[model samples]
Target: MGTRHRDEGVTMAERPLVVPNPNDPRLTRRLKGLDQDRQPVLSDVVVERPLTLYLNGQEIVTMMTIGDYPECLAVGYLLNQNMLLAGDRISGIDYDEEVETVVVRTERVTNYEQKLSRKVLTSGCAQGTLFGDVLEKFREVKLDRTAVLHTRWLKTLLREIGTLPSLYLVAGAIHGCALCAGDAVILYMEDVGRHNAVDKIAGYMFLNGIAPHDKIFYTTGRLTSEMVIKTVQMQIPILISRSGVTAWGVELAERAGLTLIGRARGRRFLVLAGSERVIFDADAGEDAGA
Candidate 1:
């Protein structure tokens, strides 16, 4: 099917698949006496589909993702890779489900040169690969603004945001990614692969005229180099997670001058980079120690 952009622009609710009632009567009664009843169970039905991203007619990369929001995933992937400058740069996106490929048509083909230069293959489940010197590219990132995150605000945002529609809540086999402006979550997405979730958010942002310079990104997954690059590509200043950050992830965040917060739960979180953007009260410091 040909890619169709929303006439009124894209909305967060339009991109991610939603499950109306996660605590359905059937599952609720079925798990009444189970110890892990409240925990999201992993489903074996999740299958990986190959999504080939074509930039301006030139084939980019083939990513394995849960087959939802194929157009958003493709556009977002290109945006994250810095292969796209603006929403208008993309002429169209064609998703051929029969052949399982996504062809992205762009107005200018020159932007993808850097990404097509050198490819490094990795052993990641999502067909992870990096083009050119990823570390060096991150070093040149110039963030537009910084987000000052308070402990209370972080706690409130996470709690409020977690209640939104998510694939993990329904299928119990996906990761979620969100874009927040202060305590308000503007975008949220879920996918069997965390990268796809982030990519979906990126795609929605691109199509909706949302600039990442003034936003905070949150994830229910580990902060890796790929994740870090995605945030950097959006020019987002802060990234918070209920997980851990890899050494490379931390290094990239520091180099890009982005704030990295991990293990964000309750009232405490570890700030790995850009501590200046976090505002903590003196009393909270004492409470953390106590």
Candidate 2:
């Protein structure tokens, strides 16, 4: 994972919302190094571990992660891959730290031998993999046309997300994904791979009974096809990112009725898809003049 730092899971008590726990022991390792002059230097390197995921009795995939929120990652990966359906009832999620493996059991027996056969290597860090069925489901999803994004909320979301304490700020080598309602960030998740962060957010939403139609999905990484697909799978109408986007990502967003906002730095953003949903309600000098 090219990160000098890692994103961990935990909530900061001082902040009213959930943020990454940069202080966690398992997420980083202290190291001694030397500069060009051979001077002694100390640094914290983010740790990556292999976690194997099992759905029922079949092995799904093993992912490289920062080792926080294993259950979320497992469930999210299954959900995003189309192995787990929205109507499925999860009976239990069992994790074994000794082996770094998680097993998700559901009331419904599942099998995905065919879906697992075809895999596409994605641009996601830590070798993000996507199954073929994901796109099939993508075409079938119909997002809420009534969902909208206000400029004021977008501005506020940018400010709050930046100020929150995160492992990315502390360690330096992680990506983040946030689930927001209006200007409020409902949850913040981070990991070595942008895919993992997104998956964690998805898993958290499924586990918590959170609805996605009226929410905004924000990420520190670029808007890629994988990102677009995952957001559509979650059924979120507005996807905002401070980073840039890919042509394919924009195309997918357009096809899925997603309001994709990118290059959202400072007070400017480019809405490449679903522009009809923007309300442009922010005031002048702090606004997008509607």
Candidate 3:
């Protein structure tokens, strides 16, 4: 449970909480598996459980997550789905770890029976799912045009992200997302699904009052229409990925004027849209060097 924040204020994290730690025993479990030599070996696997979310006493959705930052994920999921408005007042949040459930209480009454009637299978890892109604808002949302990214900062950002400890490195079965301001990582989240990770970051931004302009959203998953739409909804102008991009994702990015960069491994990356917002300050040859 949480205390109530003023109408214009945000409820801060009551305790010091660390998330996405690969070494967290609660999040990872050791299991027996066969190695390349066919010998039985102990392996680490990321733990996933059903996280059911409730909004104002109504069951919203059940998500498969790695059991971290459920509060953020719940709020972000509702926000991105358009079930929660920008001016909505959140009275409090209750998270039950044992039941693996989170309830978001808002002052305003909400319902999404019709929106939930339509579902779309997204192009995200862990078989991501999203509401079909997000399309209309996706088309109407416009990101800040003034946001820009420096090529030099991007190269460094990718290298740093690789070095950060992640569930993917420890268990090999998770996706990660990070919020960055000028190449510095602000928040990092990982879950069974890339959409979950992005939602967690969105929740963090909403609760912490972090502005999206000049911020970069990075993911280890490919850029898909779902990803593009969610990034734009969060008001983040730039998106980066270590994977490739889908055609529909590119189209949405172009429509929203979002800077989309993918294949950001080492120093090589392809800018699929909004190249005008990027400042190529790095030396051409330096991008190829160690």
lDDT top scorer: 2
Query: Which of the two candidates, 1 or 2, achieves a greater lDDT against the reference?
Result: 2
The best-first sequence of candidates by lDDT reads 2, 3, 1
Query: What are the per-residue Cα lDDT tens digits for candidate 3 across 63-143?
Result: 889988888999899889888877787899999998888999988888777877898888777777778878888888878
Relative to the unseen true structure, what is the C-alpha lDDT of residue 80 in candidate 2, on a scale of 0 to 100? 92
Provide the overall lDDT of each model, using Cα atoms, as 2-decimal numbers: 0.72, 0.86, 0.84
lDDT, candidate 2, 14-82, per-residue tens: 235666789999999989999899999998888999999999989989999998988888888888998
Minimal lDDT window, size 10, model 3: 6-15
Give the 10-residue window scoring lowest on summed lDDT in candidate 2: 1-10
Model 2, residue 287: displacement in angstroms? 9.9
Q: Residue 63's C-alpha lDDT in candidate 1?
A: 81
lDDT of 1 by residue, 1-290 (tens): 22244324444454443322344332222222323567554442344567777776778888877677788888887766656655446677789887889988866645566567787654333556666655565667799654576665687678877788654655566678888776677777767678788888888777656666767899998998888887887778999999988998899888888899999887668999999988876246443333
TM-score of each: 0.77, 0.91, 0.91
Alpha-carbon lDDT of model 2: 0.86
